[model samples]
Target: MINTRKKLITYLRKRDGIKPSLQATLVNIRCKLPDVVIFGGMVRDFGLGVRHFSSDIDMVTTASAEQIRHALAGLNPVMNKFGGFRFRENGRLFDIWSLQDTWAIREGHAQAKYLSDLCRTTFFNLDAVIFDVHALKVRARHGYDEDLQRRVLDINLEANPNPRQMAIRAVRMAIQKDLQLAPALVEYVLEQLYGTSLNLTYQSYVRQLHDHTGRTPESAFRFEPQLKIW
Candidate 1:
C-alpha cells in the first residue's frame, strides 16, 4: 500500500505537468466537435488550485453517439505524441467511452453508471468537461457534484490551480479506495497525498478525518499503479 501510494503521487505530479496544454488542445477540438461535454479529474484539479500537467482527459458531451464517434475518429493520429488511443460509442443512447492509456472518455449521461464505469477503467485519474460549440459555453460541472465539491474543497486548500479544480478532483478520486464513499474521505486522502508541508492547517483535519473514516492511512492511498494503454 505504501508503494502504491508513492506511485500514485508520482503519477499525479506527472499528470499535473501536462494539464494546461492538454486542456487547450481539447478546447481546440471543441471547435470541431461542438456540443462536447468534458468532466473528470482535470476539472476537479483546476478547482483545487493545483497547477500541474494532466495526462488522462475525460469528457462528456450533449451530442449523439454518432457525433461522439466522429469526434474521436478525428482525434486519432493527431494526438499520437501523448500516447495511443481507443474509443467506444453507443449510438443508441448517443454516448461514448474513449481511452488513451491513463486517460478515459465518458459521454452521454452524467448518471452514476457512466461515471463509475469510467472510474473503474483507469489507473491514475481523469479530468473531463463539456463544451457546447453551438452555445459557445465551456461549462464547468464539478460544482454540481457533492463528492467532487468536497474533494475540490479539501485539495484546493493546497493544490488548487486556476480553472484546474477538475484535475484535483481526479487526484482525490485516485486516493479514494472506494468510489461510492469517496466524499467521506476527501480530507484524509488529500492529506496523505499532499502532506502538511503543503498545507499545515489541513494536517489536523486529515487526522480527524482518519478517526471518522476508521480506515488506516494505508487503506486511504492504496491504488495499484498500473497504466495499461488499452
Candidate 2:
C-alpha cells in the first residue's frame, strides 16, 4: 500500500502534474490544524496512472468548517451548500470541508466516522480511494484495487443522491474507460433502466448524460445494450 501511495504522490508531484502550490496549501493547512486528506476523482484517476486527470480536488478534515474557511480565506473561499469551502487557485477547483458535514454521512445515506471510512462511501468503486496528504498514506475499499486493475465500472454504494442519473454515469464510465460492467452493476443499471427510468423523461435522460459525461445520446445508447452482460 505504501508503494502504491508513493507512486501516486510521485505522479502528483511531477513537474507537469498537480500544481505544487495547490498541494502545499492544503498540506500546510492540515499541518497547522487537524489532519486534512485528499480523495475523490483526483486520487482515483491518478492512482490508476492517468496523467490527464480532471482538475477538481476534494478534501476532508477533522477541523471545523469555520476554521477551514479562515485557513483558506486568502483564496476568497466560498462555502457551498454541502458545507464545503470552495476555492480556485492555480486554475484548479479545490473543495475543503469538515468531515462531520459530508453529505452522505451527515444525511445517513452512508456511514464513515474517520478518515479511513471516507473512501467507502463513494457511489463507484473506482472513486473509493483516498490519500492522506499529511500522513503520506493511502487507503481503499475492499474491491478498489481490483476495480482499478480490471478497469471495471461498478457501484460501491446503491443509495446515492441520484441512482437513475448514476445509471447513465455507469454506462459513460464503462465506455469512456473501456471498462466492463460488473454483474451487480449491470443488475442495478437494469433495475434503474426498466424500473425508474420512467421517473425521468427521455430527453431529460439524454441531456443529463451529455451534460454529465460530455457524451452524446447516440454514444451512450450505442453502449447501453452492452449492459446486458447476462
Candidate 3:
C-alpha cells in the first residue's frame, strides 16, 4: 500500500505523466486555496494500480466558489451548481469544488466544524483518497488502504449516499477493477434497487457509463453478471 504522501506523488507523476501544465495549475490553485486537495477517481485508480489514458481530475478546496474563480481567472471555468468549476487543459477536464459548498448541498451530514469532518463525508469507498497539494502528501481516511488491498466495495454508511449513483459506481468498479461488493453492501444495493425511488434508471445508468467511458451500456452491463448484483 502507498503509505506516504511523497511516494503517492511520485507514483502519480510516473504513472500518469502529469503534465507541466497540470502541475502548474495545481500550484496556482494552491496559492489561492491553501487547503486544496485532489480526490476521487484519479486517486482511486492510482491506489489500485490502474492507469488511465485520459483521466479527469477532481479537486476540492476550502475556498469559496468566487475565490476559486478569481484564483483560476484565465482558465475560462464554467461554474457548476454544486459549488464547482469545470475547465479544460491540454484536452483534459478538471473539476474544482468548494468543500463547504459540497457539504451544504448534501443532506444529513453533521455540521462540518472542521476540514476533517468534511473529508470524511466526501468519500464513499476506502479508495476515495485525497492528495494534499500544498504538503505534497497522499492521505486516506481509516480503512482506505485495507479496502483497496482487499478489492472490497465497502460503502460509507455514515455519509449521505445516492443509491442509484452507488449502484452505478459499484458496477463500474466491479468491471474496471474486478472487485466484489461486500455482502452487506450488496444487500444495501439490492434494497436501494427495489426500495428507493432514488435508484438510477437503466437509461440514466447507461448514459453515465457512456459519458465516462464512451462505451455502450450493453458492454458495461456485460460485467453485471460477474458482479452478481442479484
Best by lDDT: 2
Model 1 stretches astray by more than 4 angstroms: 1-24, 77-210, 213-230
After superposition, candidate 3 runs with Cα above 4 Å error: 1-8, 11-21, 103-108, 158-161, 194-230
lDDT of 2: 0.69
Highest TM-score against the true fold, candidate: 2
Task: List the pairs of residues colliding in candidate 2.
Answer: none
Model 2 — TM-score against the truth? 0.77
Cα RMSDs of all predictions? 14.7, 7.1, 8.0
**Preferred candidate (TM-score higher): 2 or 3:** 2
In what order do the candidates fall by TM-score, top score first? 2, 3, 1
Mind giving the per-residue lDDT tens digits that candidate 3 earns over 24-108? 6676678877688887667777677754425678888878888888888888999875558999876678898877666434454
Model 3 Cα shift for residue 143 (angstroms): 1.9
How well does candidate 2 score on lDDT at residue 125? 84
TM-score of each: 0.36, 0.77, 0.73
Query: Cα miss at 224, model 1 (Å)?
Result: 23
Question: lDDT per residue, candidate 2, 1-230, as tens digits?
Answer: 55567766776565545556455666566766577788777777666666565567888888888888787777898988677888887777888878878877878876667878887678888878788887778888986777777777677877787788888777666666566666667666665664334433433433343343443322223244333333
CA-lDDT, candidates in order: 0.37, 0.69, 0.62
- Whichever of 1 and 2 has more lDDT, that candidate is 2
Tens digits of lDDT, candidate 1, 16-55? 3434433344445566564444344544454434545234
lDDT of 3: 0.62
Off by over 4 Å in 2: 1-4, 16-21, 194-230
